[model samples]
Target: MVEQSTRATDRPLPLPRANLLHLLEQMVLIRRFEEKTMEMLALNRIRGYCHWNIGEEASVVGAVTALTENDRLITSYRDHGFAIARGTPPETVMAELFGKEGGCAGGRGGSMHMVDIARGYFGGYGIVAGHLPLAAGLALAADYLGEDRAVLCAFGDGATNIGAFHESLNLSKLWHLPVVWLITNNQYGMGTSVHRASAEAELYKRACAYEMYSEQVDGMDVLSVYEATERLLRRAREDREPSLLETLTYRYPGHSYADAGKSYRTKEEIERWHQRDPIRLFQRYLEEHGILNQGEYDLVERRVSQKIEEAVKFAEESPFPSPDTLFKYLYAEEGTK
Candidate 1:
């Protein structure tokens, strides 16, 4: 059976006001960034398949916030929030979405392949379940090199059934790799619901086969996610204990920009999930704790709005990659020779 977190009524550990506000601000930034991305896609400023993490802010922020600067991170294609939370500049992320030269990937990777090794964000892999083994390898390298670091690998619910997931987890457990596998179960794997896809829907229990410490969290509750991830990360860092974390979150938008999001799921179901939107839930929690008020909330909204506007301007003004450099970074020199 999957271990579920207690309801929000139990209250999370009391965090400092500054940390709480920081978490709130990060969530707002991600929400605004995603909203602006939708607008940009509509304006044709960004092309190709784009997935927005509109309602899953807490899952992204809480997990990333728990990681230290030296820790490594890898995630699947829906990665704007992950990159932004990990301290990648919004301007560069936006520019990448716009396919401009100022982007983190220099405009070539676009939305589905963002990368910033300097910030410890390994990549935004586009393939399904493909990055799991690579994350395991990163953990192995850290252990082999005697580095005091851990790897946090994030993937969608759909990936749970893939072979790579099992292989990586088994090896990670066998070798005692310092890694945390975060399964962002946003209810639907693309257009298919989790119920339709898997026999054992409570994904956290899947970790049992590998005998890894695992738990399912209320992804809408930012504090719960943060506390759980922080604890697991500490275990991995200190004891080299790998973990599997399943975050039960929801995505308001469709699998991609092209999806209307209503074909498979009903409007009422979507509305119900919207009621528990991670941003609003966390905002209410802050207000209840007297850590935030209307004025401060308004200020955050305005600041995030302005930040997104500036990022858009930056992306628009940035140049596209020159055609002359088309073949750059494609192949290794030794291989080409």
Candidate 2:
């Protein structure tokens, strides 16, 4: 078994030598996990909508790795890796996508709405930009309650243009809420490219409109993302400020699993991103640095692959939620009078 690096100090720092290895492991796990989801989708085992995290693994893993379990996470539809990195088990997440009773959301939320509140992952929202205010509100509540926890609210570039993005970011900044608006700018908002949709393509500047601190980083390099996010997240936690981090990345796969990475983006475009695949890049760095031998890296790959297989098996064997149990935990229960 791979040695679990749960100790925060023992875990890799944001460096090419150390943090890069953890980032690579996360990227590989996400890749394998998404591949399994696609296989399940093809077999009709996973119903409803699904988005591949194939290309955006670096953003989710890098941001979440900098956060503690107490920090809140809410994101848009493309959310599997975010959930996994935020502490939702692979089995529960897969089962949720599979619509089984064992799922984190009790099989109700389906592919675009996986939630594990215990892990502080509030939800994966299906409606675009639906969770922006929810995250901002979470930060507001945390502030009101004098809690030390911060919130990491993630979304795609497309949602960044929507009303909620503007409204929520403004609110968080105005009130100095403990929130980090982490936007994964993967060039396209579904089928629409960022250059076409966004009036000002440099989204981090949007934070300046709210007079919030902002940053831009190469999303493909997980080390760079972690370095930036760690600084911003710590600032947010310490000062209860709103920060915006725009990661310039690309999605090798299509907007959703239904679309097979074609149409707008050509084969050459996708192939280019494959050449810089974050997992492969860090794996190379790991081998060169001796932090991970080629043999050890292979072992990590095989172990995560096995974990994915077991998660699939668990999802396949899990039963669907019963009709009688529907709506059991949809909302918070009323307090006794």
Candidate 3:
């Protein structure tokens, strides 16, 4: 019975010193990573469709931090943030983006398909809401096997319109599977605003049709996201109750690398969201609380910048997959032919 709120809270959660710092660091790191990624995409160093998570740091970092080591994480194509937040090395992520063999997916999956199985992060799905069924399947497996594990499935607002969203929710509720369905409602799904697409713009209400518990929180506030996620996950793990959480956030960039995100969005709209930037909001909370000072914040920024540079360097130096090994990993059993 998590208390429900759809707005950002000014009060900071009573987190430990280390946890607070980790949250700040992760948000800053993600912002820097996306900024660097944007630069690389512009310079043509990284190829293929790239979606920047410039404004959704709190949604990613807060949710990921709530999960245990054994929990599974799955998400939509806006995945780099989730991957980095889940502890996949920046170097490997950049390499994957660069299509180098050093990538987490062996450079085969590229940006939309980043996978790190060892870290319990299932690959990102490219199709809209296509991964929802897979997430339900994973939850069913854990339920059937009597495993003490839960799954967190993340997707965008537009995904709700897809039939699979309803199907997954119905099944998860009926079966009492351990899963937390997180909707990162960044206001828009691609170029269209959520209002223009979803009939029930308050997405959390959709869970009511399936008799599942649902709540919405301010995605720009990392503390609120963290608290709600932690409670929901606890219920999922302990009581085997599936739930839906909608985080009200926004993405600064357009849908992908190709779209400039300006055709459908106004300059004023983008600037307004920037004023409530997740990283800046969290930083204000931390500084005002006497947890992080200007000097320490600068140190964090410098450290993250260096890490991003190293990641870029690693991507630059890593080799692309050799053509000779192209046929490898095509099947579960090799040498069949």
- Highest lDDT scorer: 1
2 against 3, candidate with superior TM-score = 3
Which is better, 2 or 3, measured by lDDT?
A: 3
For residues 240-267, could you state the per-residue lDDT of candidate 2 as single tens digits?
A: 8889998877887788877765878878
> What local distance difference test score does each model get?
0.92, 0.83, 0.91
Model 1: ten consecutive residues of lowest lDDT: 1-10
Task: Return the candidate ranking by TM-score, descending.
Answer: 1, 3, 2
Residue 190 of model 1: what lDDT?
A: 89
**TM-score, cand. 3:** 0.96
What 10-residue stretch in candidate 2 is worst by lDDT? 1-10
Ranking by lDDT: 1, 3, 2
Judged by whole-model lDDT over C-alpha atoms, candidate 2 comes out at 0.83
Task: Tell me the spans in candidate 2 whose CA falls farther than 4 Å from its real position.
Answer: 1-20, 330-337
lDDT of 3 at 318: 96
In model 3, the runs with Cα more than 4 Å from the true position are 1-12, 334-337
- lDDT (tens digit, per residue) of candidate 3 on 224-248: 8998998998899899999999988
